[model samples]
Every structure is written in structure tokens, then in C-alpha cells.
Target: MSGSLRKGLYVLSFGGIAALLVLVLWRRELYLPLSLLMIGLVMLPFFIRFERRRLRAEELLLVAMLGAIAAVSRVPFAALPSVQPVSFVVIMAALVFGAETGFLVGSIAAVASNLMLGQGPWTPWQMFSWGMIGFTAGLLRHTRFMASRWGRAAFGFGWGFLFGWIMNLWSLLGFYDRLSWPAFASVYAASFYFDLAHALSNVFFLTLFSGIWLNILGRVKQKYGLLENGRAG
Candidate 1:
């Protein structure tokens, strides 16, 4: 079989497996695996064609490192929050590998980690949030803003703030039965300090690290010439 045909078959097989899993697991609410399968389906074409050929050893290593970081960062303490800044890593991957790779990393990492930790309805939300962030980062590639340090910095900060806000909103919306408007308002009002801290931390981290991250990505691109011509491979 031709390489393209093989690649296409691989993608189709992934999709078939995902569909079967979803049909079998729908009643049990195995959302994390279902969501992951969907993400893999979305990213399969890129992985098989573009990313498979162009990904460097360093890039794969980075993906593994980021995934490990995300998995290990989850804390069991109730008082002390688990700082899963998976978005940052996802953005970095997207910037380096392009959108498809970024999506794969973000979605796969979230779902895989959740599976290890324990799956819940929240898993799907997490997957959506991280996946969207990575996809947006990839989409930003075509814009002039991603061409320079300042532009990338701005993109990171903007996305970070947006991610924080959106995730919070998703939580509120998903748990609306347990948290009514008045209760949510009261809780949000009281937790303003925590929310501000989270948002500000994201802003600061993204702003401070975006430039450095961009430089590293530029070096990788220079050395390996991956995704250099914006043609995926």
C-alpha cells in the first residue's frame, strides 16, 4: 500500500475504535476516554502525515516531558491547589509543532492524566479547555502577532487569562445544579482573591516565559526545520 493509503487507514482505524469505545462506554460516563478518542481522531491526520514525518526527537522528548509534568503536578491535598498549568505546555507545543500537534498534546495529556487520577465529568471540560487553547495557539500562527517575541507574549498572556476565565465559567455552568446563581455569586465574590491570584499568576508566567519559549522554538525550528514552510511537513 502507498504511504498515504496506509496513513488514511490508520486514521480510519482510530476513528472506528473511538466510535466503538463511545458506544460501549456511553452508559458508564467514561468521558475521559471518549473525549480522548475524539481528540485523537481530530489529530490523526496531522500525526500520520505532517507530524509523523517532521517531528524531531527533541520535540517528542518535549511532549513526553510536558506530559510528565502535567501528570505529576496533580496534588491530592484539599487545601493546597494542584497547579496544572498544562495550557502553557500545550501552547509551547503548538508554537513549536503547529496546531495539530498542540491539540494532540493538550487533549491527550489531560485525558491520560485524568484516567490515572480518576475519571469524572470534569474530565471532558478539562479536555475541551486545554484542546481549545492549543488549537487557538496554532491558529495564531498565521497571524502577524506570532512572528515576534512581543506578539507571542501577548498571545500567551491573552490566552492564559482567557483560559482561566473560561475554565471557571465551565465549572460554574457544569455544576450549576450544585451551585445556583446566588451561591455561585457569593462564592465567586468571596473567592475573588483566589481567582485574582490565579489569573495574575497566569498572566505573569505567560508574559515572562513566552519570549524565552519563543526563542527556544525558533532554535528548534532552525535546527530541525520542522514546520518551517507552514506546510506541516
Candidate 2:
């Protein structure tokens, strides 16, 4: 990507996040959907960049397969509060696949899973939240922090709650009339244990399965000659 494009994307991604916070804080309820749509539209350029770089048929299929695994990975954890392997898997894909692939895998997984679990207004939020996690990981893959195992675990832990809190906003907007500190705190408090479960589970999977998955996917990438980015390795 061009330097200008990269900078613009960063602005759009985190700028949209900042806007989301503003909407909640100021009770600009009507603008929430529009903000989300704008964010999605801004991200289209990144996807377009990937396509322009010549994403091949097999590579797209690879992303779809990974997304399918991520979507179905939640089934076994249905009995749990928030423990699931979806985020862990998505992070791994980003670690090996770069930002664009990670974004698609994360977004597609949310949509695919929700289609089976039942969709609602929250679907887009789920997609955006999870997609951001993958994008952030991919963005930082070349850094020393992401190169370390403990760092990856820490990131997974943080993203688990981030994902939950972002998802909580959808519920907040869908059910509550206005955003207040008490309401926000109450919502977060109620979901605290579930978020912790998710965080711990993500850390566990990152610590245990990251190496295994990375090794396997590394082999696959080498065999298939996928993802030409230097950061992916």
C-alpha cells in the first residue's frame, strides 16, 4: 500500500473508533449507524488494495476456509459464557496472513457464524470489532511485541474484552434509550465475568495452540506461496 493510503486507513479505522465513543458519550444515537457505515466504507479501500495487488483464487479460498473454521469453532463453546476459539484463530490468521486477509477472515467469520446463530443489528458490530482485532494484530506483526509469545497472549487477553465491550454497545443502543454512566457501568459489570472468561480462554489458546497453528499454517503458506508480505512470516 502507498504511504498515503496507509495513513488514511489508520485515520479512518481509529477515527471511526473515536467517533463511536463520542456517540455513546454524547448520546447521539441516530448517528451510530451512519458512523458504522462510514467506517465500513472507509475500510473498503484496504480490501480494494488487496484485490489490486492481485489476490488469487486460491488465496481467497484460503481466507474463506480459515473463516469457516473460526465460525464453527464457537459451536463447542456454546455452553460457556464467552469462551471461544474464534478470536484466537482469527489472530493467528492475521499473524500469518497480513491485515487485509485478517480483516476478511474476521468479518466473514462473524457473519457466517451469526447466520447460523441468528442475525440482528449486532452483526455489524461483531464484524467490526473482530475485524479490528485482526487488523491490529496484522498491523503490529513486525514489531517485537507480537513476535514474542507472551505478547501475543497479552494482546489476545486485551482484545477479548475489547470485542465484548464493542458488542455490548450494540445491545446498549438496541435496548436503552440513552447512554449514561450508570447504564454503561451496569452493562459492563454484568458482562465482566463473561469477558474475563473470553480473555482467559483467548490467552490459553494463544499460549498453547499458537505455535502449532502457526507451524501448520506456515507450511501451508510456503507450499501455496501465499501472502507476499514480509510481515506475514
Candidate 3:
């Protein structure tokens, strides 16, 4: 099969399995954690292989820096609300190195950060949400949607809305019985405002930064080409 076609099919298959596990088996505690572990496992080979083939000190440093920033941004010492700029960084990585790198950054950064904060059931959801966003952004990189400023803006907005919606849905499902239905519904209704804010903020930040980020990534790619077989060199 052609490389692009093969990659496309692989991504679709993984996504299908992930969705089924989330929708059908997420209620079972074992299933949730196991599913998350499986996700990490499924992506691990790709990450390792990519790393071996395209190991660049500068890129590694950048990835580490981005992950550290994301982790520190969520420090619970203060009551300040944290904004995740990791998604923007993930998009840049994906555009530069490709889909596998993007997914690796998103999944590893999220899981590591959450573990540092506290390992809970919520960790899996956060991993899934962030990983999925980066994965999708990477897939979109192959399309014209990420090739220009307007395209990147639209892609960022759509993904932002999707990320907020999915996070809210997961929160509701995970906390359904614990929260009184009336109160939950009221809170849920009001949550639209929060979601809107998140989406708008993501759109604004991505629009403003994507151009410069992409240019930086282009330079990185030119200086150190990515692994041909998706492995780190």
C-alpha cells in the first residue's frame, strides 16, 4: 500500500478502537485505566522508533521545555486558572516532525504532568483528550487545512471547540451520579460559557502564534530532517 494510505488506515483503526473503548467500556474502572495504558502502548513503538531515527538535541530540548512548561502551568499551589498552550506546541511539532511526534508529545506530556499532580481516573481522560487533539492536528497537517494562516485558524478553532466539548462530556459522565441532576444540569448549562471562553481563547492564541511557530518549525525541519520511518534518528 502507499505510505499515506497505510498511515491513514492505521490512524482510523486506532481511533475506532479508542472510541469504542471510551463509549462502551469506560464505566468499568479496570477498563478505563487499561484502555489508557493500551493507548500509551499502542503509541510507544512509534515514539521509540521515531526517536531513534531522528534524534536531534535541539528538538529534544524543545520538546522537554514544552513539556516542562505544560507541567508547571498546572501547579496547584495557586488558585489561578491554568491555560494549556501545549496544544499549540503540539501542532507545531506535528507540522514539523509529523503525526507520530505530535501524538507522542501530547500523550507523554499530559500523562507525565498529571502524574506529577496526582494520578487519578481523570488522568486518563486528560491524556485521551490532549492526545487526540494532537493526533488530529497531526493528521490535518497532511491536508491543505494547515498549509496557510486562514487554514490554521479554522483548524485551531474547530479543534478547540472539540477539545472543550469532549472534556465537558467526560467530566459529566465521570461525575454524573455524584452530582445532583438538577444542580448538574444547571452547572452544565452554564458550562457553555466556559467552553466558549476556552474555544475563543484557543482560537485567538493559535491565530496569533501559529504563523511564527510554523516558521520556526520549518527551520527546525530543514536543519534536522525527521526520521523517514517515523523513528528518531
Candidate of highest TM-score? 2
Per-residue lDDT of candidate 2, residues 82-187 (tens digit): 8999999899999988877788788888999988888877777888888888889988988999888999999999998998998887778767877789989999
lDDT of each: 0.61, 0.82, 0.63
Q: TM-score rank, highest first?
A: 2, 3, 1
Instruction: After superposing candidate 3 on the true structure, give the runs of residues whose Cα lies further than 4 Å from its correct spot.
Output: 1-62, 73-82, 115-118, 177-190, 226-233
Ranking by lDDT: 2, 3, 1
User: Ten-residue segment with the worst summed lDDT in candidate 2?
Assistant: 30-39
Q: How much lDDT does candidate 1 score?
A: 0.61
Put down candidate 1 lDDT per residue, 1-233, tens digits, no spaces. Answer: 35679567767867775685555344334444654565456555545655545555665666666556655544332244433455666777777667766766676677777777777666655666676677778878767877665676566556555555645653454344454668667656655554454445445556677678767877877887655544442
Cα lDDT tens digits for candidate 3, 108-167: 667777766667666656666666666677777868768877787677666666666666
TM-score for candidate 2 = 0.87
